[model samples]
Target: MTTAGEAVTASESVTEGESYDFVVVGAGACGLVAALAAREAGKSALVLEKLDEPGGNTTLSTGSVPGAGTRFQREAGIDDSPARMVEDLLRTSGPHEAEELVSWMAESSAEVIEWLVDEHAVGLYLITDYKHVGHSVPRLHAPADRNGANLTADLVRACDRAGVTIRTRTPVAGLLVEADRVAGVTVDPVDGVRHDIRAEAVLLASNGFAASRALLERWIPVMAHTPYHGGAGSTGESIVWAEQLGAALANETAYQAYAAVATEAGDILSWTTVELGAVIVGPDGHRLGDESVGYSAFAEVIASVASESFTIMDQRIYDYVSRNEPRFVKIIDLGCVPEAPDVTALAALIGCDGQTLAGTLAAAAASAAAGTADEFGRTDLAGNGLQAPYYVCRTHPALFHTQGGVAVDQHARVVSTSGTPITGLYAGGGVAAGISGRDGAAGYASGNGLSTAVGLGYAAGRHVGR
Candidate 1:
């Protein structure tokens, strides 16, 4: 351990004057990928993570990721290309996305997936074709276990095999800058020891501000009171550090708000509510938007409401899907359960008007029968009508992560507002602004986090050794 004076110098330089080729902050998806890529390019890389474990929010998430024109897609007879993927993203996320950035992500998505499979040994599973998320194509891929823990473990193993050094329980307090370039990082070890990791290139993959209440309110006002589901270490340290060095910020207002979250005590639960067949309703006891819409649209619907809503469904929906779909079984195991067997009783318990709920159900049934339901563009509901012993559980808007951060060019190089490069620093994953523009398909599932993390990390690492 070092005192404050020693800590300062530890951040500034090392006693041996030895320097690595790259230093990655936050051993999450982006950081791990960056470290692996740097090592692949014959550079010594070190990963600093504040948590005791290696995976950040990525481990907590569902392992599924969207990629276009992948080998898996081709073998499965799914016709997709980078151009189609780019067009779909531009259409779904809005035209405001940086064309250069989106283009890079789209073109490199397949390559990233291939890298994960070839190098990291991430087993691929092709499920439904973009049924859950708003992808226009069926590009989502997952490991044997749907939880992101599989992906994280795979990456950890790969990093270890590749001889990348991972320093867990080490928090990066600040960056060391020489002129406009980032030369190293100051880190506080778990035991309170301070150390300086000097490097030729520094990648800020320290995640978003979702876990920091102060930073959330300052950057994304929509998420001020919303609960965060990511790791405790996602405190926007990189965001603050980068901004202090005059780094440009982009899409500061964008964040990913899951439509339904379990109102459990500590952290927000994201997978259970939506993955199950629960239908969200307003306080008036009427169905809100299509529950099947992607996370963005789901968030928009919930955000449009002034009061918290409820999720209503029947045991039949649960039993049917749970028996038919393995993913549904996983959802049930994750804390998603049906409400009690009485619709009226459940409504009363949730403070909703039972009569109004019945009327809404009847209306929904009629619309489904007539094949005229226009809500959220959900036409599939016409097949499965609501049946008895119904259930309802209140829900609130919860944020998974912010979609915006330091602005970067196509090569993952941080750029200023005046179109000048902020030398030496780079960002990826949630630390980089989303390629999706404001006002795009609010619920489009386009692998905004995973694709950008791996794609930009690859670009940054390739640039580092060159």
Candidate 2:
């Protein structure tokens, strides 16, 4: 392990005898935010990250977080509120074990964004480009470039400015408890030397078990075979440790999956391509299913048809998506998106019958023209119609992350199976039970992950500081 000179927050490596008022596990968006909040509340805070770098899965995401009522939304002339966000989330996620968390986070989301921006100087703007998965209004906020890495960097900088020490390459072996209350965490570094660091309160923001095949098979068997595309540190050790302490688990089977990851390049193709009138087709050049089912739920559609599929879009849709998603520009630069001039050329690309491909496009065009729902019950065709000179990328479905863990109270404190809050033990982000639904991918709304991550982190730190 390196010294403070090599760390992101310019903090020294945690020594055995070091103690803080707040100790946070995982240096992702949640942990950093919690540490910053703790500092703001006049508390000593230290963050421990397993990875050498701070950001975890947050770096790979779009960095979008939902805020129901914020100044940015008000300035954009968008009407929204926490209640509206709760309704939208419930409509998409249906019934869930963490339904209370949905409302709690929704109420705290706007404050989280404002705190990150107004207080910490994290650059965030309201996104008005397109409607997100569950929200009715444009309440989702993101970085200017819409990159999660930028968000992570901003938070890291905020932590540094707040004098929050972050120790990298510090993996927590287990929780240190006294009298059934969490006291601190035992650090297990690569050199195998163990250090017991004490803290008045411990926050588990270490994310979920998306990278753990055994955990996936045990908790979410249906998605056991799905490809994982999250951080390596998400191996469910936090859940295991918490469960050993009799912490209650909720929404254990819920997760988020994406439908269109570029197969060879392993880059996310952005569902905006489909949302803007692109279609995914099977090997036979036949439409797979409704493309507008939203990305997470659409993964099941793609998986049911084939191991891999082709996302078909035209120049208009491609250019529109490229204007917003910078990652798509890189995908195009890598020659991942192949161009086909017409139906025959596209057929040659897919090795399918030209007539079959032509028939499929004709049907979609007919549906768009008539303003009627297609056979798949998709009616919201956004781009009007597809033009010649098509771009098709081979895509596959993958699991982005699991959205389940130990249950937490409204204050973000870990609770017992008997419904009592575990003293000194708080959880947020993927380490806490997600606000998404209890079972499947269909319940995940856009920004649901960050909503819980940042929201609960803010709440946990404030409560601990108090």
| Each prediction's TM-score versus the true structure | 0.88, 0.95
Give the true-structure RMSD of model 1: 3.6
How high is the lDDT of residue 420 in model 1?
Answer: 81
Residue-level error in angstroms, candidate 1, position 223: 1.6
Please provide, for model 1 over 1-466, each residue's C-alpha lDDT reduced to its tens digit, 9 standing for 90 to 100: 1212123654344432547899898888888888888898899999989989988888877666767899888998889898988887777666653557788888888888888797778675765533445566788777665667878898899899988999888888777766557778787787765657678888988888888888877877666776566677778878877777777787766667676654533333333334444567788887777766665667666775734776666675556555544554554555544456666876776677889877777766666667775455555553445667775545666677777788888778888777787777889887887776643227245467777777788778777767
Worst 10 residues of 2 by lDDT: 1-10
Model 2 C-alpha lDDT per residue in residues 1-466, reported as the tens digit of each score: 1111112111232556778999999999889999999899999999999888999999999899999899999998888999999999999988989899999998888888998999999988898978877778998899887889999999999999999999999888777777667778778777556667788999999999999889999999888888888889888888888887788999989999998899878889888788778998888999888877788888866776688888999999999888888989989989989999998999898888999999998899888888999889989775456889999998899999999899999889999999999888999999999977998898889998988889999999899878
Q: What is the lDDT of residue 414 in candidate 1?
A: 83
The TM-score, computed over Cα atoms with residue i paired to residue i, of candidate 2 is: 0.95
Q: Clash number for every model?
A: 4, 0
lDDT of 2: 0.87
Name the lDDT value of residue 89 in candidate 1.
74
Against the reference, the lDDT scores of all candidates come to 0.72, 0.87
